[model samples]
Target: MARSSRSSAPEPTQGRFRRILGKTITYGLILALLVALGVAVAVAAAVRNLPSFEELRRSPTAQTIRLRDVNGTVIVSIGPNYGRWLKVSETPAVMRDAMVAVEDRRFRYHFGVDPIGLARSVKVAFERRGTGRRLQGASTISQQLARNVFLSNNYSMARKAREAILAMALEWKFSKDEILELYLNKVYFGGGSYGVDAASRTFFGHGAEELSLSEAAIIAGLVKAPSRYSPTADAQAAVGRANVVLDVMVDAGVITPAQRASAAPAEVRLASEPNQNSARYFTDWAIPQLDALIDESVEPLDVWTTLDLDMQRTATASIQSNTPEGAQAALVALDRDGAVRAMVGGRDYVSSNYNRATKAERQPGSAWKLFVYMAALESGYKVDDEVVDEPVTINGWTPRNSNGRFSGTIDLRTAFAYSVNTVAAKLGDSIGYSTVANMARRFGITSELNTQPSMVLGTADVRVIDLTAAFAAVSAGGKSIQPYGITKVSTAEGRTLYERAPPPQNILVDAWVAAGITDLLQTAVNTGTGRAAQIGRPVAGKTGTTSSNKDGWFLGFSSGLTTGVWMGRDDARPVTGLQGGAAPARAFADFMRVAVANRPVEEFTTQVELPQWQLESDEEAYYGDPSLEAQFVDENGQPIELDPAQPGPQPRDTPGDGPGPDTADKPRLDRRWIDEVTGSGGDNGNRATGQRGSGQGGP
Candidate 1:
């Protein structure tokens, strides 16, 4: 009775204090809870307000492609190893079912976040993962899409939270089927693949539509961790994953136990070489062209160019088979309009990133004589004009012929056809270095030409594209053209932001002048240094070699196509005893034969102004390396003339210099750079007077 009385009879001040303390504690707890709730809401709102999946997926560096042969065979898939996508219109039911069973058992029923799958995944995570991957993921198809398309390849709670929010948003915006499709299409299933369709064909000989249950299950198993369970990477691991998936499906009652037992792993037919790219180099080059012409917003555009599949295959085969064992080769083909049809960057592109055909800048050797002779021919010098091939000195440098024994007197055509370097240098001198440089520019050899007299002998580091365009110009009646790959670029709905259509150009050279030039080129293959480049068809072309046997090149053309081939190491190392006519010429012949195999045979005829095989000066003058006199010009050396009266069908204007954004200062490379560069002989033995707009090798 005393204890009850004491409890009830608390002093008024003490009781008031106790009551106030209790109320204050409760209020503080409530405030803290309210603040936490508000903070969580703010974070959810921020995540929801972030960029959408499509916006986050944009990348300027992602190489987009639309590659097709002339006959419309998609010889290569289009992408540069990141953020790739492909379609699957009709896929294997077994594959689809396996995906549903393995990735999300109730995929057909869920909105985006599968509550039951997430619960199951969470339950399994606490179980650990050593004995064949027990730890599971709450990632549904939508969550996986959020991760693959938007987030980076990282594992974190923050990332997972973002994935959950985005997945929810995606489910709200898109159908469940659409979410599944995007996830399947966007996922990368290891071994240089993206999308279920690409993965199916890569792992199995069949498409996604033809995948067996085992195959489908195997692919689905890759979803958890593609590299860890790559069938090609580790068959045992892949089998283990498949078994685990089968067990899970059976346990979940998605499949019968007998069906699970019946499922067996099939042989995964991997590519011969993991990096076996059918057209690696070609595809690499093609991506840049597409990106340059089209905007990122464009989609579903298939670019059909002049690529010849047969020719490309044949060229690759020839280079792979006939090269000097470890030596590499690249090949390129172009039509009259300078549209590249087929481009093999190397013997095997996947194994090597070296683009021998397009990126290499090799000394053209005698192949450069084409421009020198073109300059001479246009400078009123005839192909039959006599020139001295004997030891000639220019600017204190003596130039020797490739054979080391020069004919005392030979016609300019004979000298060029024979690949005589000294005589070609002399003609460059006699015709003025500006004339030769100018001719090279017009021919589209925009790689900086050297002002040295020996530059006429093809010492410049020009690419295969340059050679193709220059040769194509000769075949195109001397109409200047830039090589084009994409024919047209438009969206799936046919909205055209960029349509690849090159403006036509008139003849840059007289018909007779070009005919005479090609006449010599034909002779170069028929009875001269380029005899190795001869094909079954009537062809005209030239072979090029570089100093120290470092680079070998063959540039040739028939009426139907102009092609170029190069062979060398990526480090620019010398292939001693190798010449252009040996490997490169053979590659060119093989590629051209396949490229033009189906084309109607055509011939070069008189197209524009006729030529007058003018005479040469009868002066006993030095050709190379004497008095430092790099260039000698005829009286009338000037820029090419355009006939206003005989206007062409279309006039392709040069990239006009406008009120452009302020350009950065481009530092000049000094003249004696040859001595400092450690890559040439006595400053390249070059000393030609440079002309404006020639892109000549020197400052």
Candidate 2:
């Protein structure tokens, strides 16, 4: 075949100039071909070295988190399933719709990266005349998965080039399902939780198995901008995102206009507090225990605990809401097996790592009476046994009641429930200070209990954590269990890293004897100083308001949990009108109500009472109501043994409603903040220590 008309017609112009021009054209064409080949080779090589794009294409970008009720019913979460996270595989229809709606419309048609999208983005940037080009990312699910799972925060051109290469590699390495799983596991949804697994539980309070369309939409929308679109952070933005996602789903033909219209913007329900079940409070108090348990050289352990999420929520809430002003609070919640489910050391965990629940010693005041009575019980004393509630003195320490007037004569139970200082002192004196201290230690009192008479009234300082251990013994039916935080811990790839068992010890008191004390604690709730704490259930607890009213405490227990609360000011300048049973109780009650709302109601395991006694002494003869007896006995109503104790949970009944347990302790560390070191009682936050010229509140 003769050349086409155009090829033949262009051969005319001749001579040396034509020959040189022809030669140059031929050379230019060759050079162009070579350049194109090089570009192709380089791009191909880069893609080959990158992630496996095919694996990423099938990776999951959208996931659901579900929070559930105790009965395993989904309550809330990021997506529709409530408290569950559903992988794309679990709900492909939703995932496909989400992918097409928000990401690449031609995902299946493209190899991980989309050159057409990039070119279009370049065109838009040129038109806009901006140096920094906005993204019109056409990365398929596979490419996104690759970047999310294994990429850097670097946004330079080099990083982008690397990301593209990695994307290809990921596609090659993982099957669609595997890539999707990695994608789902790596993306963030804000609210401080990492991974889809953690996000689901954090937002919806459930696992990955449950989710609804609405919930899924909410979570899926978070992928583009997790923090800004998070339901917890901006409900309006999240709703806007949900609407956009719905529209996209409809456009993609995944859902009909009617379905899109029917999709409602979900209401986000989030825990008021963050970082529950991390054992912030207990970590401080249990430091020694933890150090003893694990080797320190390799960062000790990456551990997990059997903490109940709901229970921990309540603990933090209680402390945050109820802690007295200027005070820092701390708390720990434990299972009967001695696992610390939740802990809060102070008001703001980020401000300081000091765990008030486990660190920072504070006076127990009347709260310590529980130990005195426990000591009395161990010595074979009956709760109803007569004790002179008169002037009690020891050396220079003359312990007196706030009222400075005693009830003349009272039973051990009566005094304990009332937190009568004089009576507690007498009981401790009779029991021997050494014996009482030893008993306290057995119940988990890690702090040194003073041997002085004032120690009987809880005068010696005790950390809230130490108090928790002592109380846990009471709840565990007299078994002395060491408190443990982690149950089991695993690596991101599911490799087991650590595990924990409950702290173990023998029975500190007879079952009946322990029950007897719990019984009296119930009375404290029914008609003692802790009456303010009663909330329509059998709550065995104690209310301790320090003499200065600076420190307030309410330590309580239920069949499901044991909680200790302390309220005081960071400056130690009394919380003014606030006290233990209020802020702590309110916060505690808030958490407990939600935590156990779906669970069956449970009761304490104590049951024993004392017979009404008629004292021969006139002072004893008029010991209140004869029918109102005191004593810790077995089911048969007799003192099992003189008791020993963890006085953390003393039930008190009084005239007024007050705080509940799980309260925050005073921010003792706050006062000493090196960043802003100062004295106590001054607004400027710096003053002379002894001049009484208003000093700084604390550091």
Candidate 3:
């Protein structure tokens, strides 16, 4: 009876074990079903936010804004580096092998996520628990592309789940090759480069299709740590990473042992450094104009500019070489039609982005004399007219020459060539300051001008580009010019975005007046303060030196080109002994030498004749008496005809009033005597011949 009871107890124990096993199996199945359902719901939610496959494929990447020179050579790329899109078939086989071997060996077999890799990563995480180190990522190529394109790089469980779900969607929608192609084109390779194409061009100076086996391995190795493995930043580490990629490729059977060995020691001739945008100043000045002309919706534009790269380089070198140490300088070169050829805003663009050429406004000094002299000529004054250069006062404002010594009576040509301040002031007062300011404005001087006598010597401030364009107008034969840099803008597909038409040539100044100024300016370059700017050609220019030498300028033009240069301390402090005739003029000459080396030497047009009626009208209109024209008559006193057909006198041998061959046979007149008697020069004692020195001097 006891044996029977023991056997029965064993049966009950077996029954209990069977019940426990059944419950355990039921709970396990329920847990598995719950996890699978949760995964399905998560995937569906993630997929709901994803874009359509076609939309994702058609989405535009960040395109580069390329600025090309007149010759279509790319001078600057202003946006992200997105190289030309390439297909998976277009990529080199070796690059594919290297990438797969190093980044994801199971890429070809996985459906977005690799179960084995994920399990291994989990095991590694468990083993490395409490080590305070991040666990390695187990993302496949599709998963990486999903993260790069659709998800942020956040180390959160939600982000990872979304990445996994999106990766699966990508796999379900595309083939392995398509996923690989997308992955290769979307990865960041650091240094502002995006995708394999840009990375190839940036690091190897070639295309992805042109990469060698070793080069392919090296670039592939950068997937893990691009900045850390940059060949440019650290060559040895890059080589070491490439070796690891080669070993992996060999183990993966993508390359043989001998091939790996051959590729391991292969020389990686990295491409040369990318062309830096050295013409940053010109680009900065030109971009605003470009933007204004083109619609904002038009993107990825190829801006064709008027920049002459050779001239731009020459201008940069000249400014750096001629500018005094610790002083800043700017230069702008323009064609006769006001197309900007070259511009250098400062000595070093990397150190400072202040574009002085278009933004900086400095006193032009004697460079402003061009407008004053133009006004005088338009008012019936001739180059040979003798004016009193002695000390004079206008409304209690005494004006003196730069040398602090006065010439008794100097011809208009001599006075201008020497940049005589007193002569300019007296002429400005006689012709009317309003007329001078109007002439200046007509010549494109946009800055406000004070009506004071000192304005004749350039007390007002003007931008270098405006001054350059003003001189360009003179070079273009009295036509108005709007300085422009971009000639045309188009898209990559040859679609015309913006085409710049030649602006109308509005005649601002009279042709005869412009010619007269040009003649006097030729003499200025021939023997005056602008002699340093002579380039063995017919150059017309002026030298301007401001008070305390704070601002120096050389505004000049040839028959076909015009250029202006300014030099000063950026802080507006004095540049010690610096003068326009010294540094600015030399820089102008140096830049012009290179700018016109390949062009023909064109002479200026013949001086135009000022009509008799025009001269009579100006004389009567300005002096308020037609008979006053006789006061400026020649020695014979026959109401000397001011003929533009006749050539002016040669430049004076000396700077001041001295005996020289007078071409016009004009008589010396103390214009101050006329001013005092007519109440024109100003309300002060205007001595025709006196040396009184007690006042603040002019520039």
List ranges where model 2 is wrong by over 4 Å.
Answer: 1-304, 501-505, 608-699
lDDT at 347 for candidate 3?
87
Ranking by TM-score: 3, 1, 2
lDDT of 2 by residue, 1-699 (tens): 466876666566556678899999999999999976875666567556544545533443333322223233322333211223445666446644664567666655565577787788777777877656655455667666655555534355775766776665555555555655556655666654545556667667755445445666777788887756877645677889978887888887778888776767665454344543334434334323433443222221333445455665666666666665567777776666776667777777644444567656887766676677777776777555567667756777777766556566555556666666776767777778988788778777777666876677666788877787777788777888676654553333445544564344797887756765775676565556665666666677776666667777777776557777777765556666444445655555555555556656677654343222311223225443243223322322323232124222223222222253322221112222221211122232112112221111110
Give the better candidate number (1 or 2) by TM-score.
Answer: 1
Best of the two (2, 3) by TM-score = 3
Q: Give the poorly placed runs of model 1, Cα more than 4 Å off.
A: 1-66, 79-275, 296-299, 490-498, 606-699
Report per-prediction Cα RMSD to one decimal.
19.1, 23.9, 20.0
How far residue 655's Cα lies from its native spot in candidate 2, in Å, is 44
Q: After the best TM-score superposition of candidate 1, give how far the Cα of residue 390 lies from its true spot, in angstroms.
A: 1.3
Model 3 regions lying over 4 Å from their true place:
1-62, 81-277, 296-299, 614-699
Kindly list the per-residue Cα lDDT of model 3 for residues 97-152, writing each as its tens digit. 88888888998888788999999999999999999766576988887888767654
Provide the clashing-pair count of each candidate structure: 21, 101, 0
lDDT of each: 0.66, 0.59, 0.78
What digit string (tens of lDDT, one per residue) describes model 1 on residues 1-699?
999888878688798999999999999999999976875575567456756545543433223455677787876655534323433346555566677777777766775677787777767775654556543566787777776666654555786777777776676666675666666666777655667777876777556766767777788899888756877645778888988877877776767989877888755444444555546566556755654565442245666666667777777787786566566777778887777777777776555555667767767777777788877777777554567767788887677765666556666556666677777767877888888888888887778876877677777778888877887888776677677766765554666646666686867787667776886787667666676777787788888877766778788898568888777766667886468767778877776777677878776552234321231112213222223211222222212222334432122233223244231121222233222222232311111111211111110
